[model samples]
Target: MTPAARKCLDQLRTLLRPASVATAGGFRPPSDPVTSWFCRAVGQPGENLPQWNGRPMIPILQIRIDELPYVPEQLAHLALIVVFLDMEDLPFDKPHGEGWLIREYTSTNGLVPLPEATHDFKPFPIRWTRVEDDAPYWEGACALLNMRALDDDEEAEKAFYDDFQRYDQTKVGGYPTVVQSDVGVEDFVFQIGSEEKVHLAWVDAGIAYFFRAPDGTWRWACEFY
Candidate 1:
């Protein structure tokens, strides 16, 4: 690893807390560092940044970082990769029985509550975005790694288009079918923020983590699916 990568890795190690020892009954505390970090970050309420009127807006899912071991044999180096959440224009703040953005509500004829049950609408556009302050860290990390995103790769881009086409063809029904037209992955790395920081998300040993920007602090983690 380069000196820069080593320094980044060293900083990450400081955030990790040692796992609790196993008890006599074979009971062990949660030893997974990524899981521990994720629980704490998500458990606490994050600051909701300001929103704009015209351009698309995505919520910020605040994140932190943890230590990871290097394993070069498996091509498992800590490369920075960006992940994006697909966006859609869905109804929000509708009538009580109308159900929040549920396409299937047609059967109830816009009833606020379909007899026995009511559906709650969460805040619209349920994806996260990076804050303005953290873009430099992300950019620096990407420059250090020298990696390209799937969007920048010809094969990867073609695969995405082909898969999306197949997905569109496979749909059968009409009314409730989710035709997400004008829907696309918003790279918060560029829009509403600096282009330097690539919005990154990666899985290490099956645990999901994201680089929270301004500085690419790798504190947040979760299961991908």
Candidate 2:
């Protein structure tokens, strides 16, 4: 990896570790989908389906950190947590897809590991970077945001959603929601709450991304692609 790329990765690691206080934007549902599914499956008022491809669809959580944690060991743990929560509501088989977890920095050739592991597909050019220890690592890490995308088989999808519905139904209450957006990737703002949160989320595709708030509560956010 270039000295520049490595630096960026280190910076991201710091931001993700102990975590940082920053306005995060992604996608999530106003109502917890799993909770809603359980309620409806058991005959109760639950949240409607998430919108996808223009229809009510499942929302996936995607997190991007401007800063990473100070400790390096904790980075993997934090990333895993984000991955688990993001796919917890989706219908899928594995936690992150079929293959072994591939960790790499985003690059113009695709996703290139620090050591430059051989793989298929060229990397994509990275738009962000950071300086660390006078070396370079990829600016940020990229892993499958949702596990549902792992198995293409319909059975896997069904199993994933079924498990998700069961898990949601068992929870006592719902999680709080947060919303975020950007106009042409310039103007950015976010809000966290109940109805107000939902309305902001609905303005987009209704797909809200979630992350652990500073208070430990899950907050939702979304960006218009």
Candidate 3:
């Protein structure tokens, strides 16, 4: 067997499945005949995406809180949490809100669906699925984040970065799949990968990490290779 495949298997076998749940999201096919993913969606809009100046923000991620495989207590009361980015330029060098925003809704009742996107803004619908056994798959994650390292670091060092990886998909509730240094505190909420199917790209294949601040506000950072 290929060495990489064997290494992956070994990593998987050792990962502990904690009670945390993970969910994956991806784009829906264009011909599927529906614009709204009622439970949740990615690019497509529900209530209108807010705007700055005269330009509207681009909807990138949306979650129907109660619909999740295991609802987080913090979000259980909300109908959806939506993430929107600047339509043209994403702010990597500046503070989080300079280019993006997150909004939470308690109800969707009597809301009007947004008008069809123009040639300038194309909407991509999304679908969600519950995935099993997700967790921070490597001890390196803890060390990198300044958290306490694994018990057997001296022995585990031999396998560093070569054999194991955390579940690195566009997901909620697992250890973040980072490309460079990890960002934010341990109050990790979720990470959004570059959803190529939805025309979402962060610089070049970067993913944005979301965190919950002590005061209950949300914060974000991006990492790329």
Question: Which candidate comes out best when scored by TM-score?
Answer: 3
lDDT of each: 0.22, 0.24, 0.55
Say which candidate scores most in lDDT.
3
TM-score of 1: 0.16
Instruction: Show where candidate 2 strays beyond 4 Å.
Output: 1-17, 25-59, 69-93, 98-225
lDDT of 1 by residue, 1-225 (tens): 344434444443332221111011123323321121111112212322122233222322211111122111111222211121212322132221121110111121222211111122121111222111111122332333333454245554343334221111100111111122211111111111111122222122122222223333222223222
Model 2 global lDDT (CA atoms, 0 to 1):
0.24
Clashes of 2: 37
Q: Which residue pairs in model 3 clash with each other?
A: none
Over the stretch 1-225, how does candidate 3's per-residue lDDT look in tens digits? 345534544554455332233333344444532223322233334555566656776666666565566554556566667777774766565554667777767765544444433323334444444555554534434543332332335444445454444555466665666677756336667777766555556678888878766566777778877
Q: Can you write out model 2's per-residue Cα lDDT over 1-225, one digit (the tens) per residue?
A: 344434433343343211122222233423321111101111113323332233322221112222232212312233212111112233223222221111212212221112222222222211112223221111112221223232454554343333221110001112112123321111111211112221223233333333333433433333333
Q: Model 1 — which ten-residue stretch has the worst lDDT?
A: 168-177
User: If the candidates were sorted by their lDDT against the true structure, best first, what order would they fall in?
Assistant: 3, 2, 1
| Model 1 bad stretches (over 4 Å) | 1-47, 54-56, 67-225
2: Cα error in model 3, Å: 26
Q: What's the TM-score of each model vs. the native? A: 0.16, 0.19, 0.66
Model 3 residue 76 CA deviation (Å) reads 2.0
